[model samples]
Target: MNFVLKTILEEVRIRVFWILICFSFTWFTCYWFSEEFIFLLAKPFLTLPYLDSSFICTQLTEALSTYVTTSLISCFYFLFPFLSYQIWCFLMPSCYEEQRKKYNKLFYLSGFCFFLFFFVTFIWIVPNVWHFLYKLSTTSTNLLIIKLQPKIFDYIMLTVRILFISSICSQVPVLVICLLESKGVKTFIKNRRFFIVFSLFTAALFTPPDIWCQIVVCLPIYLIIELTIFYALIIQVYKRQLAL
Candidate 1:
């Protein structure tokens, strides 16, 4: 048993060492091209009317720090699939056949959902949210000019936060399906109204204070819950027929 444990530990160490090396290489590559990542992030903000395409840095270290932070985040985003595969390889040895199959399906589904919402946030939600905030600045009267002079670090941080939130939100369907599988479809149907309200509340918490933003976030969650329920019900009916 001691020898077995030692072997497992050695394997884990080796896997971790390799993963770290890959991560370091990816981080360095991302850092080298950090400006491109920043530009992609700032594209929506740049497209807004009356706003200059430049961000200002107040502190001397702000720009450097922001570049490093952006590179780290971009590295993580780009390396997620490889990291997930490594994780699966580490865990697969211990899982039973059925559990392995479930984990495999979940890994792919979750990755797909995460990237889908990440792009959605980048292409649609971020632009709309920025546009809405920009509109607020347009309410300036002749006497008072309310121009938006965005700081470099703050803009990048806010965009990162929104993207992170959207990626997490993408797991709603996977979570709902897991719950349905555990609790059964009938219970979910019985508590469907509660889930709807909960999703709305969650959306409100994550999205900006705009109604449209909240709706945009909430609608997808609502659809996920309903679809999970529908899928679960079909599976249950199919199982019953097979049993008969």
Candidate 2:
């Protein structure tokens, strides 16, 4: 009982320590990234012809809360991978060494992919969406002048939400690959044309009704499909060699 308690305490300590480490790293990264985040967010507004946006000061604390919340969210964005890694490590003892290697690589690679997707969205996709939406929205605004003076908190929260959701969803290819390995799916080469059509349709469904938006999203989906087919081929080759 004592030994088990000691092990539990040790594990708890490790988890706490790693979490704090992740928090600190995240804190510094947020400041470093804040300017870039702000810049990307502001780009969509730049294309607006009307230079009118004013913050409604509800209370003294509102502005402060907005800044604090945004900063903390930024921190959490950088920390998520570290936190995920820490959790992986904590739970790793029961896993086989082979699984450890595979999962560790997958987790780290996933983090890298997450950052890449966010970076790309911040640089291009979101700005295009925002700009397109804003322009599209202002078509009939001659009477009421329906401009967006979006609250800082709401704006930042929305930005974070989209990026986080997109990032999570971008792991679909990885999930598909894993499923293929586990016999849940077979090689899809024969259905390449169908997959392409289906992916484009998905792009159209998910994005606003715009050619550019659909293409921007669909391109990645198609690329993922191509990658999946290639990997499935490789797996088949390895299996054939084993059978021989």
Candidate 3:
């Protein structure tokens, strides 16, 4: 038994080491092109009307830090598919045949949801939020003029934070399904209202303080929750039929 456990641990360590090595290589490659990555990230900000197409760096190290951050984020974005495959490989050894098939489908669905929401955030949410904030900056009284001069480090960090939040939000359906399968659908049904409220609260918390932005984030989450519930119900009915 001890030998078996040791072998499993050794395998896990080897896989993890390889994953880290790949991640480091990707990170350095991204750092080499960090400027281009930053430009891509700042596209929405740059497209705003009546704004300077440059970001401010208050401190000497700020620019380098921002570049590093950008490179790290780009590395993760580029490596997500590879990372997902690694995860599947890591888990496949322990799962039963039936469970392995289910997990295979789940991983694919999860990857799709992850990239879908990622692009949605990049294409829609980020632009709208930046535009909204820029408009707020345009509001000036007679004596005071507010210009939207975003800091280099701050902008990249916020953008990355929003992307990370959206990525986590994208996993809700998979998480809900896992919970339903493990704890039984009746438990989820009983707490459905709370979950809905929590989802709305989470959307409000993560998004900018604009109602439109909140709605944009909330709508996908709501749709996915409902769809997950429907999927769970179908699975439940199918199981019942099989039993009969």
Clashing pairs in 1: none
Deviating ranges (above 4 Å) for candidate 3 = 140-143, 193-223, 234-244
lDDT-based ranking, best first? 1, 3, 2
**Native-to-model Cα distance after best TM-score fit, residue 44 in candidate 2, in Å:** 4.5
RMSD of each: 3.1, 5.8, 3.2
lDDT scores of the candidates, listed in order: 0.87, 0.69, 0.86
Most lDDT-accurate candidate: 1
Report the C-alpha lDDT of model 2 over 1-244, residue by residue, as the tens digit: 9998899789989888878987877766766666566655656556556666333545678666666666677788667766786788677987999999887777766777777887887777767666676666565746667666566656666566557546754775666566565653344554468767877887776666879867876887788767876777887889889999
Better of 2 and 3 by lDDT: 3
| Tens-digit lDDT track of model 3 for 113-158 | 8989989999998998788878887756878887778897888888
Residue 112 local lDDT, model 3: 87
- What range of 10 consecutive residues in model 3 has the weakest lDDT sum? 47-56
Residue 194 Cα positional deviation in candidate 2, in Å, after optimal superposition: 18
Candidate 2 — which pairs collide? none
Q: Which has the higher lDDT value, candidate number 1 or candidate number 3?
A: 1
Model 2 steric clash total? 0
For candidate 1, write residues 50-91 as lDDT tens digits: 635568899999999999999999999988888888888989
